[model samples]
Structures are given as C-alpha cells and as structure tokens.
Target: INGARLIMVATPANAHGDIAEQLAPFLKDDQIIMLNPGRTLGTHYFYNLLEKNGLKANVIVAEADTLIYTCRLVKNGLCRVFSLKKELHVAAHNPDDTQMVCELLSEFYDVIVPAESVLETGLSNLGVIFHPVPVILNIARIEEQSTFSHYKQGISPTVATFLEKIDNERIAIANALGVKVDTAVKWLNRIYRTEGDTLYEALQNNVAYTEVLAPTTIHTRYIYEDIQTGLVPLSILSKELGIENSAMDCVIRLASMLYNYDFYLNGRNEGIIDFQKIINSRKVAISR
Candidate 1:
C-alpha cells in the first residue's frame, strides 16, 4: 500500500471509512486512492475520515459511480466476469484533480471518464435504486436460501414498478441538490444499450444481469452496504433539502426492523457528513 501509486478500495461501502483510517498513515501526497464504486457521497465520507485521522498527506481521493465490471467469484481462485461497462463516471474529492485522476486510471482502464464533481458521481450511483429494494421485497426467498437471479427473477414487474418509484425519488433528490443525473431507465439504456419504455423493461433486456444471482442469506451487502452508504446519505440530503423521500424512508425503516438495527443511527448521517459543507462545496463547484 505504501509503495503503490494507485490504490483501489473495493470493499463494501460500509467499510470505506475504516479503509480510509487504515490508509491514512501510509498515504502519500503523490498517491491516488480510488473507491471502486463509491455508492453515494463516498469520497466525501472517506475524505472526512482521512481528515479526522489527522493525516497531512495530500493523496488524491476519487470515486466511481459504479463498478466497471459485473462479475462474481466462480470458485476459490476463479472469477466469472459477466460484462464490462463501456464507460464509467469518475470524480475526485477536489474537482480540479478529476482529470489527472481519470488520466492515471485510464492507463489501466479505458472506460474511465471525468465527471463534473463528486456530487455528480455520488448522485449518479445506480445501486441506491437497484439493490436494496429487491432484497427487502424478496426477504423470504433469500432467508430460505432459494437461489434466483437477482435482476431477472428477483425484480418482478411489481417489484420493478416500486423500484421505479424509488428511482424517481432518487432523481428528485439529486435535482434538489442542483446536480443532473440520469434516470435509472436512461442509465440502463446508456450503460447496456437496452431499449425500454420503463426501468423494469430495460433491466429485463439487460443480458449482463442474466446469471446474476440473489444473495443467499438475509445478511448481505445489498442492505448493509447500499442502505448504509447509498440510501442513508440520499435520504439525509432529501430531508436537508426539504424534499419528500418517503419511499426511501420506508425502505430504510423496513431494513432497520428486519435487522433490528437503527440504520440511520449506524449508517451515514449528520454525524458522519456535514450536509451544509457538502452543499456549499457543490455550489462552489457549480459556480466554477
């Protein structure tokens, strides 16, 4: 880690802060740290952790809106890659470092592209809309250890409809924050080139999701990771901006009840993020 020029943090979102804390002492001014899929506000949260750790290193922190590959471990030492996204949106904690970060990352991945800022990359996180809802709605099968394709069979027409509602709320929150983001339906079309009038149709058309299986247990990253780092932050922003996010709120509450854990208390919230600071930062970035 100390000798690496580029460090990719690929752990679940819930562990990002811990990873930052661990890396703080070893990080150098010239190094670049990237959160593979920052989910939402990941760079901000991670930077805050670095600051709290009293690190003086000027390491460039960057985040991607989503992972570049759809893959799973096939065995102990083998992995199966379903597909690779044609393009990926990436941004740095400091807006000015975005291009350099993208350039550095491009040497390894051609799909890297600069985003407006972390706000754009964070709000553009599609997992917030895609992961938790299906798992929550299909808790029965998951607990029973019933194997099924996550996107294909898990997201039925009705579940997909509910997901669309959640996606709309996510878009509305992003708009309220003065960031432009693609709708989930449009994102599917853009990322997978699948044509559909609705998000469900587009998801159904995505062959990349064909063999993706649902989590076998109730304790999965879809809830702990997505809710903690993705929806929790979005919900917090929605409330701060006075936007109605009952759909998100409901999911958060349901997850809390199912897990017997207070997600808002444990997840990313006012305690971890300075809402006003982030909002002002976005405004400053936009004005430039």
Candidate 2:
C-alpha cells in the first residue's frame, strides 16, 4: 500500500466521501488522489474528509472538469470508448503542484491542462449543464419509453433556453468568485468538435452525442444526483455570490416534487467547501 503514488477516483459524486473514508487508512503522505469529473467542488469533500479523519496524509488532491473518455460498459469487463475528450482541465489544491500532477496525468491522458485551481476545475464541470435540464424537460418522452436521442433530439430549443439560464448562473458564480469558465454552448462546441450558432445546434450536430439514449425514469441520476450535486451547489453558490438563479432553483423545486425528496436538506453544500480559503491557500502553496 505504501508504494502508491497516485489514485484516480471515478465514482459517482455522492460516493466520493465514502471512498475516501475507506482509503484513508491506506493512503500515505504525498499520495495523489484525483476525482474524475468532480461535478461540484468534490475535491473539497475528499480533502476535508482526510483532514477530519486526522490521517495526516499530505495528499495532493485534484479534480477534472470531466471524465477523459466518454464511455459505457457494454458488458461486465467490457467497455466501449466513445470520443476521448479533446481538452482536459485539472487543478490541485496546491496550485504549485498542479503542473506536476498534470504532467503525471498527461502520461495517461494526451491532454492535461492546468486550471486556475481546483475551484476552476470543479466549476468547469459540464454535468451541471448537460444532465438535469434535458431530462426534466423531456420527462414525458422518457416516461413513455420514447427512443429519442438524449442530446440530438432531447435538447430542443425550449430545453436549450432553460439550459442557457442555468449556464448563465454558472458563469455568474464563476465570475463572482473571480474565475474564468465557459458557457455551456461554448464548452459543448469545444468538447464535441461542433460548429454551431446555438446550444441546441451544437448538441444536435455533435457526433459524440449521436445515439445517446435518454433516461427512462425520473429515478435516474440525471435528476437525483444532478439535483443533489449539480443544481443544488449552483443554487447555493448563486445565493452566496448574489446572483439570480431562478432557473436552477425552479429545477431543484420541481425535482423535489417529482421525487418527493428534500434535496436542499440532503444536498452537498452543507459547509462542504470554504472555496475562498482553498483559493487563498493555493496562493500560499504556490509562493512557497
């Protein structure tokens, strides 16, 4: 166990803390743990857990903007690789170590770009933009077991308009926190190698989204986890940063009604992060 140098965690956002807890006993000082596609500031959760456990592991924790490979397991132990992401974003809790981590990661991935910090990597997560809204908007089609493609046909103009608002709030939160990030449209274009004048067009024309199937029920993670992890934090950050996040709030409320669960009380934003401190510490970490 002592020989471990880096560990990449690619679990559901909700399971990250649990996994970190399990690994706390084995993790040694200076080990690297990276959260693949940290939906909403997930690195903070992992870092905080290690500290709370009193592990004294000087771990280099980091997170990615999204998973490197878009893939599915067609069968047990069988995976189908979709498109490898063209651009990958990552940052460490310590900004000075970000380049080292990215260089190490680049050995495994063709592209590993440094974000401002983990804040930028976490905020850059497109899961908040991509997963929830279209599922909610196409509930009828989903419930009816329609074969509509999740991205190509599911995201109509109406869905795109709603996504735009969510992206706006996301951008606003980043701006308020003094980080630069992308709108969903611009991000999608870059991620999918698509040329589009609009978000809907970008999605529809993107080959990566072709044949993507819609979720079949409201019980899916697209709603549950996205609301709990994605929209919840966006709404929380919007409130903190004094931005209007009506669309995000409305989505949370609607999801609560649909599933009859109190997402706010059960969401991930309960002192899960002191983002400003994380940023400020990065400055100190880099200056040393």
Candidate 3:
C-alpha cells in the first residue's frame, strides 16, 4: 500500500458508530474519511458528530456493492488479500466535491462509479440483507440442539424457499424505506466473481457453506448486537414507513427478543455478548 492520505474502514456494521466516534479526533480538516461499507447513517453520523464536536476534517463516505475483496490478517501488519473486486460505486456527502473525491480514489482503484450522493451509495449495502437470516434461524435450531449448521439446513428445498421468500421481504423493506438495495444473489456474484445466478447456485461450487458453517460462538457481536444496533432500527424505520411485511417483522421481533435476553443475562453478570450498549441505544430509534 502507498502512503495514502486517508484510510477507509470495512468492519462489521455494528462497529461503525464506535469507530467513527473514536477516529474523529485524530483527523484534520484537510484529510478525508471514508467508510468502505457505509452501514446506514454511518458517514453522516460521524460527519455530524465531528462537526458538532468541533473537528473540521472533510469526511468522504463511499459504499461499494460488496467489500470488493475479503481480507484476513495472516500476521502482524500483513493481511492476505483473498480476493480483488473489479468495479465499485462510491460517493461523498458533500455534493459539490463528490467528483473530486471519486477522481482522487480512481488513482488507487481501477473502477470507481461516482454516485449522486453518499446516501444513494450507502443504501446499496449488501450486508443489510445477507447477514441476519442464517444466525437467527440457526439460533432457533441451536435451541433444539447444541450444534447445527444452518447452511446445511438452508440447502434443503424447503429452507431454501424460505430464504428466498425472506430475501424478497428484505428487498421490499429496503424499497419501502427508500434505501437502494439489490438482490443478495447479485451482490454475492459480484463479490465472489461467480457466474451463478443465485447464492444457492454459487454454493454448489463451494462446500464451505455446507461443511464449515460459522462457528457456534456465543458472542454478542453477530447475532444480538448486530441486529439490535443495525437491523432492528432500520426495520423499525421501514415499519414506520408502512412496510409491515411478514419476514421483516419476524426478523425484527427476533432481534428484539434476543436483545432483551442479552440484558437479562448481563444483569446476572453472566457471560454476555459485546456491544450491549448498542442494544440500549435502540431506545432512541424505537421511540421515534
């Protein structure tokens, strides 16, 4: 990597708010801030918070369709670039300087699709639809058994149909909320560089989903915190806009239940999930 003037972040959506808050102080007015995957309101929230806190930096937020690549640290300061994305869309909040930011980025990136606004680019988040179902549905199965791979379960015709239906509901909710979202299948292919039409079709070529599902770790990061912080608030916003579709409703309710369960567990000083504060912060969104 070159001596870049700015660095964008790509972490789980739940971490966006906290990271943005912490990073504001280190940045200067001439520097830029970018969220590689702008989980709803992430950039704007950081920008506003920085302005309110008296930080004068120029923040630039972009939303690529997918991470554009998967990265894992192999050693200290060395991350393996497991993949490379072909093209991506990006935008800046300041409409006047959007083109300038995109032009600057194009020097490092091969293809940069300049978007109308950061909001338009941010709304195209792939994680929004793909992340929730497997964890929640698997949790239901884990309640029935100690260990289970929902991926194997998802391959069944019945469960696959359920996923498809639920995905449609996610898209509907996004549309109703005026968030730009595409089919999960499309994003998967774009990110994975696959020829398949759907995620299931792509799965046929790889056994990871079937054989090696996500570990059944009892961490609060993915299941409880993610939904409470990211999905539930978005879902509530969607519902308020009259998008009370069944699947979205179910997902939201499940997150709410899990969040409450997390509180009860933490109250007893039990092994708790992290990001509990995120769940508590939902009071603000829920009350709106």
For each predicted model, how many residue pairs clash, with residues at least 3 apart or on different chains?
0, 0, 0
lDDT of 1 by residue, 5-25 (tens): 899987788989789888888
Better of 2 and 3 by lDDT: 2
- How would you encode candidate 3's per-residue C-alpha lDDT over 39-108 as one tens digit per residue? 5445554565555555655555545444656666679988889656666777665667678777887888
Once fitted onto the true fold, the runs of candidate 3 whose alpha carbons sit more than 4 angstroms away are 1-4, 52-54, 75-78, 140-158, 173-181, 186-212, 220-230, 259-288
Winning model by lDDT: 1
TM-score of 1: 0.94
**lDDT tens digits by residue: candidate 2, 1-288:** 579798988766767767877888788888999888777877777777777666776788888888888888789989899778777889887778889999999888888888878778877867778888888788887888888788878888888878888888899888877778878888777666688878888887788678778887767877766777678877877786678999999988987887789887777665666745654554565567
RMSD of each: 1.7, 2.8, 7.8
* Candidate with the larger lDDT of 1 and 2: 1
Q: Which residues of candidate 1, in runs, are more than 4 Å off?
A: 284-288
Query: By TM-score, who's the top model here?
Result: 1
Which wins on lDDT, candidate 1 or candidate 3?
1
Candidate 2: misplaced stretches above 4 Å?
275-288
lDDT against the true structure, each candidate: 0.87, 0.79, 0.55
Task: Quote model 3's TM-score.
Answer: 0.69
Sort by lDDT, best first: what order? 1, 2, 3
lDDT score at residue 130, model 3, on the 0-100 scale: 46
Q: How many backbone clashes does candidate 2 have?
A: 0
